[model samples]
Target chain A: MLKNITLGQYFPGNSLIHRIDARFKLILTALFIAMVFCAKTPAGYGLIAAFLIFVVADSRIPPRLILKSLRSILIFIVFTAVLNVFFTKGETVLFSWRFLTVSREGIVFAVSMVLRIVFLIVGTSMLTYTTSPILLTDAIEALFSPLKKLRFPVHELAMMMSIALRFIPTLIEETDKIMSAQKSRGADFESGNLFRRVKSFIPLLIPLFVSAFRRADELATAMESRCYRGGDGRTRYRVMRSAARDWVALGAAAALTAGVVVLRIFGL
Target chain B: MEILRAEHITHIYSPKTPFEQKALDDVSFSVSPGELVGVIGHTGSGKSTLISHFNGLLRPTSGKVFVEGEDIWAQPKQIRRFRFRVGLVFQFPEYQLFEETVEKDIAFGPKNMGLSAEETAERVREAARSVGLDESLLEKSPFELSGGQKRRVAIAGVIAMRPRLLVLDEPAAGLDPRGRDEIFDTVRAYLASGENAAVVVSHSMDDVARTASRIVVLDRGRVALEGSPAEVFSHRDVIESTGLRLPFVTRVMHRLRDRGFAADVSVRDLDEAADALLRLKGGGGRA
Candidate 1:
């Protein structure tokens, strides 16, 4: 059941979006998020939505997977939407029952809020879905390399991040194995009072933590045996280089942000 | 009467996902009282998945599992009870040990069953004895124990429950020859009561050939071959095709047979092979 976590999952494809430089994609994603927040009018949202749809299609990732990513946050979206619909005070009342009010403006606010959150998640997920974790971390290290001049451990941080990302699936598999082992011993993780259910996880957690520590210790030894010394003077096998497509993608993102800012200034 | 049975069990992992796989397919297996069944398979032959169903750790996608004549999943709420009835010692069980003391680790299974404190302690002692763990070591922390001792403690934890059917997955893996023999001996002794049965899952045919009354060879999630050790090992071609080999002595005997000598090709272990060779030497030259 732990395998259902689809966050940060990457789909490999030779599409135009996948071919874009990882660093540029990261910057473009940040720009898109800022532009999404800048969108205030319906026309602004429409423009950003159209851009996102086009990017999603070009990414060549299956639509079903993108929809699946949205499912994880469906509850949060609905909760916020409900809160906005019932609590926001507005001039044009659409429905009223006792203290709970659903006004025309409230409905519009709820829709806009939902759209903003959806765009934010979809846009960020697009970045992850297109770029591999290793490339993403490489881009992060590249973007933050200037911090090294301020005595920051940029390479060390990147190494730790890549290692953590590498072990997610391994740790997940270990968790599943330990859960099954404990379950065979008649440890019930399902169907109990809240305290009882939580208490059951003690057996599961203790073993998981033990195994994780053992694995980390072994990994450290293996790295040391190979003369790994904290990413000092490390040479890249695949150096990051931006191409014409990457520059065009960044230009489009800049243009979209400019358009949204213009729309906000005009109050359109 | 059969102690455990799986009828046409089929299991699919991560169904409908890109990583979807059919781990087991239309496999029927059963173990009777006083029987030791060996399930032999190479890696990814569905040996682990098949045994998981015997104790209701996993529900088959399209089949049924019966523990002592009752469908285990019939009352989903009571599946834990079935787990207690069918004790499973997972692969490399040493890594599963977590209790502070060896004694407490052994008692974990029985305590979960809600046994009285005295009963649980008594069972712990018996299990420790069965696995050859000393009472003096019980008070010591499990983490302080050696690898083999920790493995024994983990096995004793399941044995403390005294399940009617005990299933061990690759119990002898990653052990020296003596350690492997000790584990098999403990498994054999567990069946001395005549009321309990056990299933040993292993990729090594030699580990199970001597003790298993019957062997089931799994290949790509299907039961490729099933019979007594002598009966199954006789089909050398089929066993090899499944990515498994015959017991070492059996292969030797087969070699002798191929060289025009009258040797018992069914001999499973070294001692049996020695006796067959001695008899052949006494019987003049070739058959």
Candidate 2:
């Protein structure tokens, strides 16, 4: 049951989006997020939605999987929508009851807010679904290389992130094993009240934490024994290079953002 | 009466996904009381998946599991009761130890069964004693023990629940020879009551042959062979083709027979092999 997490999971493909340089994809995703927030007019939202749908189609990731990613945050989306619908005071009231009001403007605001969140999630997930975690971290390190001049440990931070990402599946498998072990001994994590259910996880969590620490320590030892000294004097085997497709993708994203800004400026 | 019975059980993992796999397929098996059933299969041959069904850990995609003539999954809400009846000690179970003290860890299972504090303590002590753990070591942290000792503690944790049928997956894996012998000995002692049964899953033919009263060979999710050690080991070609070797003693006896010595190639254990050799010597060594 713990295997359903699909957020930030990469799907390997050779589509145009997958082949684009990870650095460019990262920039494009940020630009898309910024543009989504700037979308105040219906025309701007429509443009953003069309661009997202196009990106999702071009990436070739299964629609079911993309929808599954959204399912994880469905509660957050519903909560925000409800908050905006009942709390945003407006001139035209659509519905009213004791201590609650839903106005025409409130409904519109809620729809736009939900759209913004959905677009933001889909846009960022497109980046992760196309680029492998290793390449994503590499892109982050490259994009933030300027921070090195400020004496920041960008390389170390990136290395840590890549390692953590690599171990997620391993730790998840370990948790499954440990959970089954506990369950076989009559540890009921499914039944009981909320407190009791959470209490049952003690047997599961302590062992999981212990195993995680043990794994981390062994990994560190293994790395040091193999003469792995941080990012100092490191050389790259797969250098990131911009291709024509990458340039075109970036230009399209920039143009989309500018168009949204222009539409907002014209009050469309 | 059969302690456990699996009827045409088939399990498919992640069904409909690209990673879909049939881990078990139309396998029917049963264990009578006072039987030590050894399940031998290469890795991913569905040995682990089969044992998980004994306790309702993994519901079969297309079959039923009965514990003592009652369908285990008949009442899904009460599945935890079957877990108490059929305890499972997982592979590398030592990693599951979490309580502060060995005593508490051993009592974890019995406590989960909702036994009184006194009964839990009694079972804990009995389990610790059965596993050859000292009373003095019970107070120390399980993490402070050696790998073999920690494994024993983990086993005791399950045994303390007093399951009628105990299933262990690769219980002696990665242990020294003596440690392996100790683990098998403990498991054998647990079945001395003549009212309990066990299914020891392992790839080591020698360990299973030494203890198992009956052997079941699984290959590609199907039951390839099932019989006593003598009956199963006689099919050397079938066993070898399944990517498993005969017991060490059986292989040695076969080699002796190949070398022109009139030895019983069906010998499944060291004692049988020794007795066969003595008879061969008495019969002038060659046919």
Which structure among the candidates has the greatest TM-score?
1
Q: Which pairs clash in model 2?
A: none
Stretches of candidate 2 off by over 4 Å are A85-104, B249-263, B270-287
Model 1 clash pairs are none
Listed in order, the DockQ scores are 0.74, 0.78
Give each candidate's interface RMSD in Å: 0.8, 0.5
Tell how far residue A44 is off in model 2, in angstroms: 2.9
Chain B TM-score, model 1, reads: 0.98
Question: Per-residue lDDT of A180-241 in model 1, one digit per residue for the tens?
Answer: 99888888888789999999888888888988899999999999998889766889898999
